[model samples]
Each structure stands twice: as C-alpha cells, then as structure tokens.
Target: MRYVIAVAETGGFTRAAERCHVVQSALSHQIARLEKDLGTRLFDRTSRSVRLTAAGEAFVPVARQAVEAADRARAEVEAATGVVRGRLAVGAISTVAAVDLADVLGRFRAGYPEVRISLRMGMSEELIEGVRQGALDVAFIGLVPGTRPKGVRVRKMAHGELVAVVAPEHPLAGTEQTDLRRLAEESFVDFPTGSAARRQRDAAFEAAGLTAEAPFEITSVESLAKLVRANLGIGMVPEAVAGELRGLHVLRVRNAPTREELLVWNSLGPSPAAAAFLSGLGIDPSERSQRSGRSERSERSA
Candidate 1:
C-alpha cells in the first residue's frame, strides 16, 4: 500500500522505489504480486513513462488511507504505553533554527526523558532530504517561501536575515551596515554552493551589482567560523551562528535576504516517535492528511 501510494504520487515505479528506498526490481516484484493477487493491473507502463490504470485509480485512495490508519493506530498504542519514548533523529539548518533547537530539545527531554533525540545540522537541502528519506523525524530549515516538497509537510516558522561575519581583529569588523560590494575584492569562505546561506549571499551580490567569489566552501557553520577566525576570508552567516563564535563580529549587509525558516517532517509514514514529537510541539497532524487526501484525489480524477 505504501508502495502504491508512492507510485501514484511519483508517477513511476523506479521513482516510487527511490522514494521508498527499495530497489526497482524488488518494488516491481511486490506490485506484480499484489496485482496477481488482486486480479487487476495497478499501473500502465511504457518505456518512457508510467500511469495508474483505472484499477489503480480506484485502489490508491484506499491504500493511502490504510497506510495512514495503520501508522496512527501504532502511534496511539505507543502513546498509551506510557511516555513517548523512542529514538528520533532531528535535523536543523546549521546556521539558523527559529526556536533555539537546543532549548526545545531540552524541554522535550524534560517532559519525555526516555525519548532519545539525536540532533544533526547541515545545509537546508541535505537536512530536508534526510527527513524526506525517513532518516530524520523532523527538521528546521531555511525553506524557499511558497514552495513545499511532496512526501513531507512544512509550516513557516520565521523570516530572518544573514550577516557578514569577520573576526574582531579583521579590517572589516568595525564597519557597520557595510555595502556588500565593498567585499567583492576580498576572499570569501562560504557555505556549499546550493546552501541557503550561499544563495542569499549570491542575491546580495546581485543586488549590489557585484560578484563575490567563494574560493572555499565549508559544509559546517562552525567550520566556516573557524576559517574566518583564522583570517582565511570573510564569512557570511546567520546572526545566531555568529553569536556562537568567539570574537566574531557581525557586519550588516545593506540588502540581505531574509531566510524563510520552516519546520518540516515526513508526513506520509511518520513513525510513532516522530508523531509524538510533533504532537508535543503542538504541530497539527490534519495538514498532512489533508495534503494526502488532495494528492489522492488528483490521482483518482486523473
């Protein structure tokens, strides 16, 4: 049923297998067996594309509902067992987390002491992928506004700005509200190319009608801070990360972009632990169900 939902959502067996993290052959075999047992074809396949058969259109909604109901039943059972206690992997964008992730985790620990929480930080894209692939329960990320990825649900958390960072002893540290073009001639140690911080930096440069070259790309915000502290180059980071680095001074950009922060999680097949975490955070589960229902409706009417 999960496979069927994935197939319908993604529109191809190979893509569905990727979403489900299974090999294409294995996913295909399972669907074939299901069809053989049900005595109807679920999909129409061609060399270039795949579409749901009429039978598939009839079955996918029920399949999605079944999968969601099973998840809810399991979560309810676990909730009744006592406290919400299980391992949960939580991801955050390294530079900015709207609610002070450590504080939230501390409170969550105080309430559900038995729940083992692992926090990992990286670029928004990578962390979102971690949540989508079921490796992480939830994430706080810098999301592009007005866009939501399939297979997960997100809520806008906050909009915050990035600041140019330099060591206190560096030449640019004393300047306030510096125009970004001033640094166009300086070396830059920045986030990886596709990271939210890097994108904002690029936009800032464009706004200034200048280009800032990043000769060194670091994945971790801490690493970028260290490099900047060592006089490697100027660094661009969120205000929160700058606060953490000793002696790092923040220089404001004239027209820096405000990051759209979001709290995102896998809605399709949330584990009991993930569901509990969301509930504890007061996140509504109905949004996911509604989104799923809409997708299933679209597929059914196709």
Candidate 2:
C-alpha cells in the first residue's frame, strides 16, 4: 500500500523506487504481485505516461486511507507513550547550513531526543530534487525565486548579496566598490555549471551583458576562496565566507544581483520525526506564512 502510494504521489515508477529506497525491479515486482492478488490492474503504463486504471481509481482512495491511518496511529502511539522515535532526513547546501544549523540541531536534539536525524549535504538543485521525490523530509537551499514542485512547500529564509573576493594585492582588493563588468576579461574561479552558486554568478554576468571568463570551475566556496587567495583567479562568494578566508580581499560590487535561501518541505505527510523537527525550527509545517521575502527576479529551484 505504501509503495503504491509512493508511485501515485511521484507520478512514475523510477521516482517511486528512489523515494522508497528500493530497486525499480523490486518495486515493480511487488506492485505487480499486489495487483495480481487484488485481481485488477492498478496502473496503466505506456512509453511516455502512467496513470490509474478505472479499477485503480476506485481502489486508490481506500488504499491511501489505510496508509495514512496506520501512519497516524503510529504517531499517536509515540506521542502518547512520550517516545519520539523515527528517522528524519534533512538535506542542505554546506554553506547555507553553516549559518544556524548547529544551533538548530542542538535545539532539535533536546526537543526530540529519540528522533534519528540524518543530515545530507549537496548542491541546491539536487537538494530540491530530493525534497520533490520525498527522499528528504526538508532542505535548505538557494533559489532564484518561482514555482516549486506540486506537493512541496517553500519558505524564504534570506534574500542577500554576495561580494567579490580577490588576492590581497589585487587592484580591486583595496577598492570599496567595483563595477561588475570591469573584470569581464579577468581570470575567475567560479562554481561549476548547474550548481546554484554558478547560476547566481552566471545570472549576474548576463544581467550586466558581460561574458564571464571563468575557466577555473569549482564547487566548494572554500576552494573558490583559496584559489582567489593564491592569486590564481578572483571569485565571488557569500559575505559570511568573504569575512573568514585569509589573505583575501572582499569587494562590494555596484548593484550586485541577489540570491535567496529557502526552506523546502512537504508538510502534508511528513514523517512523524520530521514534523517534530520542523516544530523545533519554529516552523509550523502547515503554515505557508512562514515564508519571509521574495526576490525581484523569476524564481528558480530550491
């Protein structure tokens, strides 16, 4: 029943397998066996599409109620017994999580001591996908600003700007502010393509109508700063990181485009432990009003 629900919720077998943490063949076999026992087909599959058959449409609601009722019963029993024990999967970008995660985790541990917290770190795009597929209970990510996945919910945490970092002896290091386009031809150390950090860098350059010559691509903000300090190339990094990396000069750029940090989750059917974890963050999972700010530009993925 849970596997069927996952398949229905995610819209495809492959995604359902990922969410359930099972091999596709195993999930298919189990679901097929389930259908055989029920003596009716549950899904109609084709090369490009999958949907419920007429009998499936009639059966799914009952199956969903059974799954949801069992979950609620388990949550209620845990609450009544004062034993909060379930796994909570959380994902985040390394840099963003550094802001207040230690503190959040500390408080969360105190509140739900029996809850097993699993922390996974990755790029924002992948993190968002994790939330969409129900692999992660919640995530902290950087986004440009726009529509999110159908069932996932989003709340803005911060809307902010990043500054340029250069070697201490570099010309722009001593300057209070620099024109963004002036360094178009300079060697640059930047985030690799398809990463949220890279997207921000690319968007800023495109907004200014200047081509970036970032031949040195990287993923870690720390690594990017190290390269800048070595005088290999200048890089753009968050203000928090700019303040910390040794021998690096931080320069404010004129009208630098901003990025947003967001908390993404699916509140409707989150794991019991995950829901408790959200409460510890001062987030009422069901409250959309928890979202704070909006970027002026179009929205991107979490």
Candidate 3:
C-alpha cells in the first residue's frame, strides 16, 4: 500500500521507487502482482506518461489510510515503551500570534529526532477541517470571539483584538484610537470575502449596520501589509500581529473585532507524535474540556 501510495503521489514509477528506496523493476513487479491479484489495472502507462486508472483513483485514499494506520500502530506500541516515532502533520494560520511556531517546531525537532514533521500554512477554517479529516494531526487556528470549531478537541491559547494599520503618511497614522464607523469611511485592503480572516472584521462592520469596501483582495497577511504600506488602502489585523510588522502605524480600534487563539486536534485521539508535541508545549493531550462545545483555556508561555 505504501508503494502504491508513493507511486500515486509521485506520478511515476521511477520516482516512486527512488522515494521508496527500491529499484524500479522490483517496485513495478510488486505493483503488477498486486494488480493481478485484484484483477484490475491500477495504472495506465505509456512511453511518455503514467496515470492512475479510475480504479486506482478509488484505491489510493484507502491505501493511504491503511498505510498510515499501520505506521501509527507501530508508533503507538513504541511510545508505550517510552519511545516516540511517527509522522507529525501540523497545520496553522499564517498570522499565528500566541505561540512562536517556528521556535516551537525547532524545539520539537531537537527533542524528537526520529519523528518526521510536516507543517502546512492555511486559513483557519481549512486548518480546522484538516484536523477533523485526519489529514493533519494538530492545528493552530484563530476564530472570532464567541465562535467555536465543531468536531475537534480544542484548547484556548490566548485572546486578542484587531487594530487598524495604516502607512506612515496616511491620515490615521500616529492616531492612538479609532472606531469601526470611522474606519469604514476609508478604503480597505483585506483578505478575500467569505474567508474566516475577512469575516473577523466583517462581522464588526455588520453589527454596526455598516458596509466597508475592500477593493483589493489579498490572501496573505504579509501581502496585505505590503499593500497597506504602499498606501493602496488601510488594513485591519490582529493587534499581536500588527506589533510584529514593521513600517506600519498600528491604531487601537474602539469597536475592533476580537479573536481567540486555539490549539485543535482529533477528538478521537492524537497520534503519538502529536501527543508528544502537545506534552512538549505543556498541554495535556488526555485532558478533555468540560464546557461541552467550548474548549477550556490553557495558555502557553512565550
């Protein structure tokens, strides 16, 4: 199954064999034997290309799950004997503030040299879904206040509010304070509409019965800051994130939206590597929240 999955992901047999650390001929022989046993061709090969047959498309996902389950089972047994070994898949939003991700990952690698670590940067909603679907073992996400992600175990790490950020020469620069209504009058540059990042501020404007226009849609926090620094339009970002961005004037907004930083993992249970990561962060992986849908707060030190 691992070989098949490697082949599907790599898109060819030669590369898949190299990745599997086996000769191409042996890998091909094994695949052919498996296909013959199953009475179906998993891939179609030509002189120029190799692609999965319809049957192969249907088989790869299950194959991946089986392979992962086998690996996890072995890792769990090893962990029971006081050793950790397995893959750790982590996801997070680009603008994480409560915990320093790179530093955390660096420390984790130092402590668990045998564990393979992978990190993915995405929007909050997508990261939540990744944890729920088992594609990611753990995730760090930010959500609007009073909101909670469904179907995953969560722990609140910290809470923060949004602030207005403008270029140094903008009219709002050097201003200590502003409100949502006042900021609504200015053009804005923000995340794409309908995204959770965009919705954080959008909900505030909506509650005030106002509509703010963000003509430039940006998908990344860094890009949005760059656009704002160029005086294209003003922007709203988490207060903690604003402090880290150089060359921007950060202002406190009276009615700014607030968000909560959270750590999420599979509700069923965390993988061994994930459990180790949680423990390293001083979080108890076995602890469950008593607040029903909402997770309890467990802040980490910087």
TM-score of 1: 0.67
TM-scores for every candidate against the unseen true structure: 0.67, 0.69, 0.88
As for lDDT, the candidate ahead, 2 or 3, is 3
Candidates 1 and 3: which is better by lDDT?
A: 3
Q: Identify the superior model by lDDT, candidate 1 or candidate 2.
A: 2
Query: 250, model 2: CA deviation in Å?
Result: 0.8
Which candidate wins on TM-score? 3
Q: Which 10 consecutive residues of model 3 have the lowest summed lDDT?
A: 293-302
Q: Is candidate 2 or candidate 3 better by TM-score?
A: 3
Candidate 1 lDDT tens digits, 1-302: 89888988998888899999999999999999999999999999899888899999999877865775575566567778865656678998776656877888887778777667899987777777777666677888774334355566776677677778887788887787776668788889987776565776776677668897899898888888888988889887767766777878888877775566778888675666777677777777546522221233111100
lDDT agreement with native, every candidate: 0.75, 0.76, 0.87
Give the winner by lDDT: 3
At residue 268, candidate 2 shows an lDDT of 60
Descending-lDDT candidate ranking: 3, 2, 1
Which 10 consecutive residues of model 1 have the lowest summed lDDT? Answer: 293-302
Candidate 3 backbone collisions, by pair: none
lDDT of 3 by residue, 1-302 (tens): 78898889999999999999999999999999999998999999998888999999999888877887888899999999998999899998888988999999999999999899999998887888888878899999877765667778888888889999999999989688999988999999988888778888888899999999999998788998999999999999888899988999999998788777889998888999999999998999988732424553322111
In the range 118-145, model 2's lDDT, one tens digit per residue, is 8998788777777766668798877654
Q: Candidate 2 lDDT (Cα, whole model)?
A: 0.76
